[model samples]
Target: MMVQTGLPPMMAKVLVYLFTSDTEGLTAAELIQRLRVSPASISKAVGYLERLGLIRREREGRRRERYIVLDDIWYRTWSVSARSIQLGAGTAQDGVSVPAPPGSTSPISA
Candidate 1:
């Protein structure tokens, strides 16, 4: 499913696991064991999610870094992206449809 969405399957799995977990965070080693992915794969997926601002990294005292799903990660992610989408919608409404990329189309009609 994630492959169809142009995301790595492990990355999607990592996200689902994080969001569904009772704990707020997980270490890479734990994620590797739980997800049955390579250490490198865990690192890669964590990096991707961090870059997306869906997760945050916290360093323990002289220990491994932990990746946490922010309390309002989805809200935060969509809040930022929504602004961009709004700008695109405005541009489209202003007869500058070409300024917005095809992928930037809003789900709601302007």
Candidate 2:
């Protein structure tokens, strides 16, 4: 479902796992182990989610970063998606339709 909404598969997996997990947060190692993905994949997904404001990366001690889902994550994600849809719809409405040259049988040609 998240992928269908235009989120990449890896990011969706990381996000869903983070929100659904029993723990408060998960480190990159933990996410990699649980999701069975490469470090690079987790890094990319984490970066994407962070940029979207769905998740935050907190410094744990001096050497590790834990990724936690932000409060009201569902609402935030929905708002983001809604904004994107609205932007797309606006762009579609602003487009100029080209008419068929002549003698075209297409229903929308005019």
Candidate 3:
């Protein structure tokens, strides 16, 4: 269902895990351990989720960053997107459909 959000596979995977965890949050290290993925991949996926307003980052004490998915995540995401639209912002996907990749003839996946 969430793949329709146009997220990369790993990012989508990360988001699903966070959403279904039934906890307030999880740290990057925890995500890496649970997902068995490279730190860079987890970082990239988590960063993307944050940028999309689908996840929240909380800092605890000195060195921990916890990623949380709210129960009303879709509402929060819509609110953020609505605010951006009202502020005259363009979505990153705005022009994605108009171009074919330079070196490849394959159609871009949705």
Candidate 4:
């Protein structure tokens, strides 16, 4: 299901493991071993989630970065989405005519 939702299988597994585990954070190496995925994959997913603000990374001592899931992650995610929708609605309301191609009506209502 996670793979279908645009997450790699290993990345999804790592996230699930983190969600289930009692630890508040996990290092990349620990996640890699637990999920049995390549370092590159873990790094890529971590980067993506960090950018999305779904997960946070804290720099532990000795150059290690620990990843954690925030309790308000969903609130942040939905807020971003809502903000985007507001922007889109505002743009649509700014007299931008819908450019309907041929017979199809444009989804963006004028």
lDDT of each: 0.80, 0.91, 0.81, 0.77
State candidate 3's TM-score. 0.65
Q: Write the per-residue lDDT of candidate 4 for residues 28-87, one digit (tens) a residue.
A: 999988877789989988887777677889999979999998788668757767877898
Give the best candidate by TM-score: 2
Pitting candidate 2 against candidate 4, the one with the higher TM-score is: 2
> How close to the true structure is residue 99 of candidate 3, measured as C-alpha lDDT?
68
**Where does the lowest 10-residue lDDT sum fall in candidate 2?**
92-101
Compute the lDDT for candidate 1. Answer: 0.80
What are the runs in model 1 whose C-alpha is more than 4 Å off?
1-7, 80-110
Better of 1 and 2 by lDDT: 2
Q: Which ten-residue region of model 4 has the weakest summed lDDT?
A: 2-11
Residue 47 accuracy (lDDT) in model 1: 92
Weakest lDDT window of 10 consecutive positions for candidate 1: 96-105
Q: Write the per-residue lDDT of candidate 3 for residues 1-110, one digit (tens) a residue.
A: 55664567898889888988867788999999999999999999988888877888899889999999866888976786678666554444554555667777744634
C-alpha RMSD of candidate 3: 8.3
Full-model lDDT, candidate 2: 0.91
Model 1 alpha-carbon miss at residue 73, Å: 1.4
lDDT of 1 by residue, 13-71 (tens): 99888888887788888899998879999988999988878888999769798888888
TM-score for each candidate, following the candidate numbering: 0.65, 0.84, 0.65, 0.65
